[model samples]
Every structure is written in C-alpha cells, then in structure tokens.
Target: MTQAFDIIIVGAGMVGAALATGLGQQGIRVGLIDKAVPADFDAHASPDIRVSALSAGSERYLQSLGAWPALVAMRATPYRRLAVWDETPHPLSRLLPGSLTEVEFNAAQLGADHLGHIVENSVTQNALWQTAQAQPDVTLMTGQGLTSLEQSPDCARVTLEDGTELSAQLIVGADGAMSQVRTLAGIGVTRDQYQQQAMVISVRYLGPPEDITWQGFFPSGPRAFLPLHGAGDQHPDETWGSLVWYDSPARLAELKALSDAQLMAEIGKSFPDRLPHLTHIDAKASFPIARQHAKHYFLNRVVLAGDAAHTINPLAGQGVNLGFQDAQCLQGLLKEARRSGDDLANPRWLGQYEQQRRPANRRMMLAMDLFYHLFSNQIPPVHLARNLGLGAARALPFARNRVARYAMGLDEQLPGPVQQILHRLPGLNRI
Candidate 1:
C-alpha cells in the first residue's frame, strides 16, 4: 500500500527533523524518512567530534519546535566571547612595533549572555527526533533508504529499499551534500574542494568549562578551540573541549597518526599559548573542506533544504547554522501554503524560497572563500594588510558589535510568518 502525506522529508538530520517537527505541529501530515535513527544519547558518553555553532536565531527556532530544552538537558555549551588573531609577522609589524594582530568580540557588548552555543550534531538531531516522534501528524520511517523518486505536476512519489512507497504534495531533500532526492530531481551543484583537511580532536582538559572560543591563523590555516559542556552534573570535573586544526591533507594524516602523547605535544607546540592544556584525547577525526551550492533549490514539485541546498566552508563554523536558516525560511513558506489551501508544491512558492535563500547563502560562501584565500596567503604585503584591518576592527566597538550580531544570525529581518511564530513562542518575542 502506498501511504500518502502532505509532505515527505528525506533525511532526518537536524535540519530535516526540524522542518518535519515544525510542519507536524501545524497539523500538516509529514512523512519523515531516514536510513537510520540516531542512537540514544548517553549522558556519560564522550563528546561527539561533529559539532556546530548554533546562533541565537537557531536557538529560538528550535525552542519553537520544542527541541531546545531537551538539547540543553543533554549537553550545550554557550560561548560568550570570540577571538581571532593572525600571528604571522610582517615587515610593517616589525617597523611599527605593536601587539600581535588580534580581534575579540564580546557578547556583553551586545547585551546578550552568549553569542552562540557549540553543540554536538547528534544531540541536536536526537532532540529533534524526539519532538518528531511525539507529534501525531508525523510518521517516521527509519532504516529505509530511498531507492527511487518520481515527481509529477500533482505529487512526488518515493520508493524505499524496504519496499515501502510514499507519495506527497511535495518532497523535501533535507539529505546532506550527497542527496539522492536532489540527484533524482536532476539538480546539479557547483562544488569547490579546498586542499585543506580539518583535523578535529575532542579532549578532556583540566581547566573549568570556558565561555570563550578562539582561533589563531598561521601560514598553514587556522587552529580553533571550541569549549564543550561536561558529560553531566554528576561529572563536573570531567570538562571537555574540541580542537580544530586546518592544514594540507598530508599534514593532517601525519598529525592523526601521532601517538596520543605525541599529538598532545604537537598541539601544545603549534597552537597559541592561551589554549588550555589537554589531559586526554577523547576522540579524533578528519574531514576535507569543501563549498557546494545547488544550481537550483527546487525543480517542479521537489525542493532542497540544508546541505542539500548549499554547503559552506567550516572555517567560520556556519555550515549547520545555514542549514537551520534554510529550514526556517522554507517552513514559513510551506506553512502559508498549507493554511491557504494552495498546492504546497506550487512553483511560485518554491521559487520564493529559492530566491530568498540562494543569494544569502551564496554571499556567505563567497565571504568564506575570500577569507580562505586572503588569510592563507603569506606574502609580506598581504600579512601587513590583514593585520592592519584586524587592528582597525578591534578599535571599532560599534562595528565589532554589528558583525557579532550578524554572526549570531540576528541581523536579518525575520520574515512575517517567522516573526509571528517567534512572537507566539513565549520568551522569544525579542529574538
């Protein structure tokens, strides 16, 4: 038997699950399909290597979907300050004789308690999954991979490997970069792979949990530190943090192959002196850096969201945050369509989503690309220019606060529907 739903979402990652739960809460029938459900989160488990810096906007939206509190109860670390510095020496710096180039942003300057939260991807996904499972309008089909997808003017149809068939007025491609739904829809993506690989290590440190995150740029790339919450209240002494080292693939491999002691020593030698001392390496992994943008967000009755729509460089840690913004924008549009009794798959409505998000995402991608090329260059002139810019930015408190607010995803004027949703959410009217 072919089950019918108002919408079928492919992939149950954080973004997909958020969209599903939002729609289901509105009384729209939602079919959420994923290859596998996230395993239960253990309070005592080591921190996951994959993490995202979620902005205030994302926090509000998740709270609206009833997932934020669960995530906080699981594990969430708030970062109140951000520091970026370039340690490279230039002829100008030697002549002028000043402190090393560094810029800092403080949440207190903006009257906010935190600029953002660094959260494990799995924890957020599991929280959203719980919300989805509790909604009567949501039907989750787990362990079922997509085998075929067919879309027509009236509806989109999908077949799963487990022999289950489903149809919906619209099909959402919330899958990651290698999205099957996007492929089947004949949408192509423009991709650029950075030669650098990010080596991520989770470590147990001796210091108390910190509220600041920092990054230092070298000729190779940037080394970043992200603070994480402890396992639970019972283990207050067990503090954790993540280290991101960006470099050529070969260098990453060499680093990854080091013994735990050797790797810890290497980190101490290479990273800035301000980085905390690590007592233990809990986990380690590496992934290539790449930027990908879909040629189109939607075609016919099919559409894309999250990584399926675009993937950005992780240098600024905005990858998943962008995905959440995509979900927020698309959910607003779809909600309006459902309320008006219009075809949810209407090309005009889908085009609006594409038009609204594509350019914004492209701008961010290009900004990161600019940063990658500019800061990665070691020429004396380039170094001097960047340092000067950083020094100037450090002196401009108003501009720094503006940029910090933008990074927190508060600069954008929320759309009408999204604003209404936020207003209805208790304690989020100001967000």
Candidate 2:
C-alpha cells in the first residue's frame, strides 16, 4: 500500500513527535513513523533512566503545542538554581590569592520562577505522541521501520520494512545520531568520540526534593545531580533523582561491574559532599560520549532535525534542548512556506533553515568542545586559568545573566525581526 502526505517524519522521538504535532496543529498533513510506539505513561510508575533538562524556551514551545500541560500533570521537576564548581586544588590558586572556582545561577536572579525542568524522556515523548495522534491532519505509523529512502526533485519517498511506501513533499530525518534517513539521503556526518563514557543512574533520595541541580568537576570529568519528581502524589520530601558520572571507558566499565551496594559506596565517595543521600537505585546504564554534526542539514527534498543533524557532549545537558530548538526553527520555516504557496521541498526553503541553524549549532558545539577540553585535563596552566575564569564569571552579574539566558534557550526565542537583526551582526548568532 502507499500513503501520501504533505510531510513525512521518520522517527517519532521527542523532536520528531514535536515537529509532527506542531505542523499538524497548523493544519498541515504529517505522517509520523517509528519502529515502536512508546508504552503508555503512568505517573505512579518508576521514571525512565533517560531524562532531559528542558529549558524555559523548550517549555514555551511545548506549552504552545499543548504537550507541556500533559507533561506537568504526569510529573516534572522544576529546578530554580544551577551550581557548578571545580574540586581540583589548582596550585595557581595559592599564587592568585583567591578561591574563585565556583559559580551559581538562580532563577530569582533572572526574574524567572524556575530555570528549567527535569523530566523523563519517555514522559515527554508520550505526551508529544498523544498530542500528535489527536491532531486531525497527523497520521501515525507505529511499529514500522524504514526500509529505504529515495528523493526526487518534487518529492521524497520512503519504503517501510513491511513493503509499504509513503511519499511526501519533504522528508524529515529525526531518527537520532544514527539517522537512517540521513544515511539513505547520502548525508555524511563529522564525528568525534570523546574518550570518556557516561554512567547514568536513577535513584530515590530520602530527603526533600531539591530546587537546585549541580555539577562538580574533577580532573577525570564532571559528576552531575539532576532532581526528579517523586512518583504519585508524594510530596517533595519523597523525591527521586539522576546521577551522571563521566570517566574513561575502562573506569566506567570497572564501576559498572560493582554490585549495587558497592556502587552506592563508590558514588558516595566520588560525588560532591552536598549530594542527597540515595536510599534506593531504580536503574543504571552507561554510554560513550561523542560529538557529531551532519555535513549538511538538508539535501534535495530531504531535511534533518534534532540528533539527525547534530549531537553534542551532554556536559551541559543541551543535547535535547538543541533538538527541540531545531524543531521550532524548521516548523516556523515550513509554516511560512506553506502560507506563501511555495513548494515545501524547495531547496531555498531548506537552505534558509540550514543557514540559520547550522552556524548557531556549530557555535554551541565549539563551546562544548572548549569546555570538555578545559575541564577534563590535568594540566596545571589550564587548571589555573579555569579557576580564575570561574571566579571572574561569578563577579560579573551582567555577563552571568546573559549566559544564563542563553543557556535557558531564551536567546533563540527572541522576536524574529530582532533575531534577524542580531544574526546579521558578526558573532551574535552564538549568543
């Protein structure tokens, strides 16, 4: 059988599902394809191991799509402060005569109630899926995998594993880091695998939920704590959270082999002193870290979004936020194209999307690379410089607010006219 739609999106993860819902709500026909449908979200169930730090800008986008409410109703942990510091005792600190190795940002300082939320990836995906499925112009193709993809001058076609074919004016690749749509479209990626692997564990804390999220940097890597909402109607006193430990692959493997009790002991020793006492561990997993960017965001009648186009180090928790931003940018361009009666697959339109997003994404990638290198090294000079820099950042409130706003994705949410004006200014796109 064959199906036709205005646009067909491959991969129904958070970004893909958000794109589908956003377009469908605008009355554009959208076909959403995924290999497996996510199981129904239960508020009382244990949270998924995978979670995302969703910024305020992402929350606004989801609110517009009617997904935010569902997510909030299910469960979302709002963090009002972010604390980061280096635990390394730099020899230069003695010479510098001051300890400035710590920085913190509070929502109150930014005139916002909360900086962001920590939600399970599955919860957000399920909410977006429900929103998309409820839309009249959206078609869901669950339990179906893409077999092959071909693009003509006028349209893109994708073959399904079950022998079904679907055609659309444009095909969006949101299939993630190993994007099948991007590969079949002949798109190539530039990838750099960091030597470190990240260990993620979901745990329940005996104390009250924290309003702050923190990362303490060590020579090996940063150890992060992200608070998660407690299951069911429990109060903040009964909270859960996630722990991320980054280290070399061999070290991570060694840690992974420890029994749960031994692992808990290791965590207690390695993490910052302020981390909450972990009463129970719900789940644990690990994966290598890498930075990947598609050589081109689009080609012919196909385009890419989210992890399909770029994947960055999770040190700052911006990977999924960047994906959501991609969806927002592409959705606007497509809507404008539709209103103007232009071909949805026009190269010019896709080019514009790429032109706007690629530089911004590239700048973020570079910043993360800089951070990864500066913090993960044991060089004495680098350590001294980083400590001084952190101290300087703490003393500069104006600069700190700007950085906090940028981190929260507010810079990308500026009015279109203002954004265009800023984009024309050299180096402004990155902020």
- Model 1, residue 205: C-alpha shift (Å): 0.7
Error of 2 at 328 (Å): 1.0
lDDT of 1 at 285: 98
Cα lDDT tens digits for candidate 1, 1-431: 99999999999999999999999988989999999857999887888899988888889999999999999999899999988666666565464323334557788987989988999999999999999999999999898789999987788899999888899999999999999999999999888787788999999877688899888878889899999986456555767999999999999999999999999999999999998768889889999877788888999888999999888879878788889888989989998888778999987789889889987787566545544433345665434334435334233333333333344354663233222222232221211
List clashing residue pairs in candidate 2. none
Note the residue pairs that clash in candidate 1. Answer: none
What is the model-wide C-alpha lDDT for candidate 1?
Answer: 0.80
Model 2 segments more than 4 A misplaced:
94-99, 231-237, 373-376, 380-431
Q: How far out, in Å, is residue 282 in model 1?
A: 1.3
lDDT of model 1 at position 87: 65
